[model samples]
Target: MKLSLNSFVVVALFAQFASARDTQIPLEWDKKVTWTEKYGPQSDQPFSGLLSFSHLPYTRCLENEATKFDIAVLGMPFDTGVSYRPGARFGPFAIRSGSRRQRATNGYTMSWGNSPFNQGVKILDCGDVPISPFDNALAVDQIEVAYSTLLDRPSAEGMGERDITRLISKDGIEHPRIVTLGGDHTIVWPILRSLHKVYGPISVIHFDAHLDTWEPKTRYPGQTTDQSRVTHGTFFYLAKEEGLISNQSIHAGIRCKLEGLADIENDESVGFQLVTADDIDDLGIPEIVRRIRQRVGDTPVYLSLDIDVIDPGLAPATGTPEPGGWTTRELKRILRGLVGLNFVGADIVEVAPAYDSADITGIAAADFVHDFLSLFLAEKPPSVGPPAYREEL
Candidate 1:
């Protein structure tokens, strides 16, 4: 049979395939495999002991007597402080659920060159603060008490004074730093009070569309001088009045309509410098980072991120949606630039999942929390001079 080149090639390929198929691995080898023992249960099974933030072990504040943790993930589920929307109470749950996506990756950040989880720090989710839905004031008090309890050591014989500035490890137990999953912006006020007790007046790195430094107003439409007047819009005012924050504090990404000239004046009165969303255009992100580092130099800092700080197009699940704002990438860059700052506590707030589609806002909030953890766990830079306060004119 005179074979063309194509016919010869086809015959050769078939012969090779038949020969290869005849030498397949023995069936006994396949039967000897312990598939269930090697892989354990199904890969898709829901993770146990998972709380929001990583798949860190779950522990309650009251029950952590034996296990000492360096960082505690807490959820504040109260949202009575919001003026525009009511669903921020679900912020913590949504943020946690979104964080499950982060579990597969080995907590390595290229910028840090180390896994934050691999740091000497031990992290635990302390679960959510039990807050009252009906009483805002009571809920705030509950949050404050819960936070204080987590950060403070109980008075006991031979247990010396608690140091708020640094985590203390005594008698085989360690004090914890807190990362709050927020109910709303107002939750910061109570968390600040808790932090002030430990770190004294800390500087705040506030990312929000509104200043959140407005004077207190009625809680609702009909009420006057209500006890719950200190709302999400006005908690920073309360924080400043209570001496919880330092004058070096700064606000970024503010683009909401303010109450005429007085609003700016009022915010200045609270001692925060403004880095409006427009400023990102005028001054590049590096300059913005430089300004923030300059403002918060060497001070114990608390970061409060309102989800609305990002543009509504990217993060539409927040209570207040502002048109002109930051992109998630820009925000991430700014946050990464803030590594080595003295971050004692932080929160990602105003995430109302009801307003969200496809969990975009929730994922952003969770990732922000992750970035914060990385920065907090990273080594501190050498101390600069005492952070200077910017006074209102």
Candidate 2:
């Protein structure tokens, strides 16, 4: 067989394009911080930990513990509350596997500030909470229990009967920062319950395709189906009713549902703000960030990210795919804009791998999760100025 000159040139051009595509834009933060490879499980070093969830560490929130790490990565691995899909229960495992293949460090990369590792930030994958299939209530209960242990209250405050003084004297400390991986959006209820119990009056920044304010039961007429009758749509309402959250502080993204528009208009107590799909173009990214900041303020923010907030074409693996959702760049910009605020905790929910062929959704979900942590962790600790020097001279 003879190859023509045109064919040779076409192949050469293809090689050049592939080479360019393979290259990544070098990160700017790499110059400021010292980078090191991790040695064991969850560490950036070569190890078998990231590949399998079973080997991931589940450390106790004691003063000194075996698996003590600063930023604990927990897997909620349950989706029973979902009224639309059953596979999100497998989300945590899929995300973990994806992280291993992606080969990115689970720690903060120094883009805007110092590396989290150098700043005493630790990251540990605390494995998944045990889950029961198709049982929303049980799943929520288990998640609460798992997080309660992680929160680490003293025995006097109804924690496990461990010797407090003895534990505190050691290196490990309880009440460490927590980063959660979710099975579905309903998982937010339990996490909020736990965090609110510890950090009261916490504000929430919700990224989703709906306001998620629908009452589980409403009197609206011609209601063929009560959209909020199940766990999928009633998380916020439940949180509000239980007094676990301040309704005024909630911010939602790209909401498109008209099911509860009248309810929002008539309600006084629940002053939830919606950044509807129509507003995305008119308001723009900076304005959206301003609105979120205005609504949330300096209150300790809890970020709840539902993958469905992205357009279905970009994220088809979610249980409820809504059109006209935020683009990836927009989401990245929004998250980056949230830096320096008091972010107490966060969760990335609703990633179902069973629906996608290329694992693109999971990859996007992982990177989004990574970027959220990076931005939050890289934030500079508020400066405490030195004592007044007027007397010096």
Candidate 3:
């Protein structure tokens, strides 16, 4: 048989491939392992004695000998109080996972000029409350009790005594500031009730799409069950009724749908002035920051930031997402603007990782927590801000 030039080239290429295949290393079939990690898990993880945030593991507040610390990062793994979705019970895990890379040592970022890690404070990762997923009422009580126990604890003996926020406790003692990783927005009501015991009526800086102050009975008209009354949507109303929060609170990024215009009036009756998401365009970011500062000036304030406050397009892991919200950049800039406020404690909630993609929502939530720690320090940001960075460290 006569062969064409193309056939000759094909045979040559086939023979060359067979020769290359013969020289290649054979694939491993056995399952025996030889590779080993160079360092222990604690070297990179933030927590000690567990699989959680990169800090000291703690949840012994109920015990008589819980480790004492200045500031603690607590997790609320209860989402049963949510009105729209489930799975936020896993929010603490996701947020903590997002925060794994954070180390207090060399924790400086040029964006803020300082890092929460280097602030001369012992901020431990107090692990999540063992909230009962079966009962919302029990879960709510558990969170309140857990938070109060930690909130009332004494600050680290010598550290954070230099804090100048003028925030005083009922006992005239220095109390620890807790940055909470929340399961849902309903967690705030219990937190406020807890802080009320320590700081009396504290102010609020609520960042969310909805006016969570809705009077459930009035707004829903017929779903008047006791459980329905105190959901994520109506916890603020419950707080106002219980006098856990002050009228001095303000709500930024308000743009959620309401039952009617009466919802605005109800929110006002609950003592919140609205700063809609669109207000950033007309009022400007600095002005919005000014209003928040002016309203809560030196008062013991609690900041509750919902992950849904950022546009769903940017952070979609939230249970109740409303479009046309602030970008993560604008949100961070506003948070930085709030550097000097006398906030006692704060939470970033409604992070349902089941709906999230690319871990954007979790990263945003974790970074918010980082900012929360810095805000407690109350160090004035530089006039021009921290120097820009070349790349990630």
Candidate 4:
């Protein structure tokens, strides 16, 4: 208490040292520290391992001992069928790159109350189909063959099985579902062919700005049939001719101007009811869901989402973007409402990233795929073990 100035200085120095020694430092001072190798290997780098969809493991469907997966994502990089834009050939890459955003979390959706990646489903990116760039006919045939090859792969045993009451197919075989990242809407034709071979003519829930059911028209006036004219606009027409779709199919978010009134008649003739973009305000999301469920009740459905179905302000990097369409929020809500529908396959197409602004369209496309996967996983039976997120995280 009666210390001198020099004594006070010495006491303060000793107190400071004591405090510093008492504090527990985070680093191990006795251990050898190497600055260059402090973090070990960088496994999460973009260039490492397989660049498959959403950075998932890459597996081949045609391999000798292929890993059985519940869902397979195959990229169809063929875009010759586009009538307006050509760069949708790069859509699958853009979508996969943008999907890195979802990897930070557990890939969970609050809207669905579950993570698609955590529901005992084994998913793999099976890579892109080998497509012909020069010959459209040959390209179509190649896509059909590639899709069929993947569809024929056996599903993972006892993984992500649906409820017994929901298994309506008489064959007792639970085929693996596909989530195709698109080249264009034309890819749906070959997909329809493949799905038909497995589960006969399916009901479709088509979302687009255009009807995409146009008759094949010739460039010249004197032609009887345009054998070389299988554009994206005419795929559903061809599907109708081949009896690949049921009358219960429906089209939503359609707002494009048509060549004539016959286009609606033609689309209706091909077994599709129309719900234009303008109808969203009048009917609301719940009514729209009711309409869709009532139209394709208890049938196997193939969901096709064209990016142009979203407003160009939100998703401008599509092949044929129209002015009037749904916002991203509206689209997500509508997709979430389609929970119990028997969705066998789905695709999000027409994303041309060259025209995208700051990857807004790519991110939107990735979100759609995520939402589709959530819907698919949510429809499965209860998991036999703890959820993957609970155990892995």
Tens-digit lDDT track of model 4 for 1-393: 688999999999999887787684435567887755666755666544556777787776655346677788888887888878888889998888778766524676666677778777688788888788888889889989888777777787445455321264446567778899988899999899988887788899999999888777622233335444577888998898999888899999999987678778888998999899999999887778778878999888999999999999999998888997999999887776677788889999999998999899988998899888887877632233223222221
TM-score on alpha carbons, each prediction: 0.80, 0.72, 0.84, 0.84
- Candidate 1 pairs with clashing backbones: none
In candidate 1, stretches whose alpha carbon ends up further than 4 angstroms from where it belongs are 1-38, 41-51, 153-164, 167-175, 217-223, 380-393
In the range 315-374, model 3's lDDT, one tens digit per residue, is 999888899999988988788787766778899999999998988888788888887887
Residue 120, model 3: lDDT of: 72
Better of 1 and 2 by TM-score: 1
Q: Which ten residues in a row have the lowest lDDT in candidate 4?
A: 384-393
lDDT of 2: 0.64
lDDT of 2 by residue, 1-393 (tens): 999999999999999887776575344444563343322333533335535322334443432344455456788888767767768877886677656543333343333333333444455566677767756566678788778667553221211221122233232333555677888888888887887766676678888886666666563234435333447667777778778777556555656656455767623355477776666789776677668878877666788889888887888888878887777767876676666556767888888989865877877887676665564554332122111111110
List per-prediction Cα lDDT, in the order shown.
0.77, 0.64, 0.80, 0.80
Model 4: lDDT of residue 73: 86
Is 1 or 4 the stronger prediction by TM-score?
A: 4
Candidate 3 residue runs with Cα over 4 Å from true position: 1-42, 45-50, 54-61, 158-161, 164-167, 383-393
Name the 10 consecutive residues with the lowest summed lDDT in model 2: 384-393
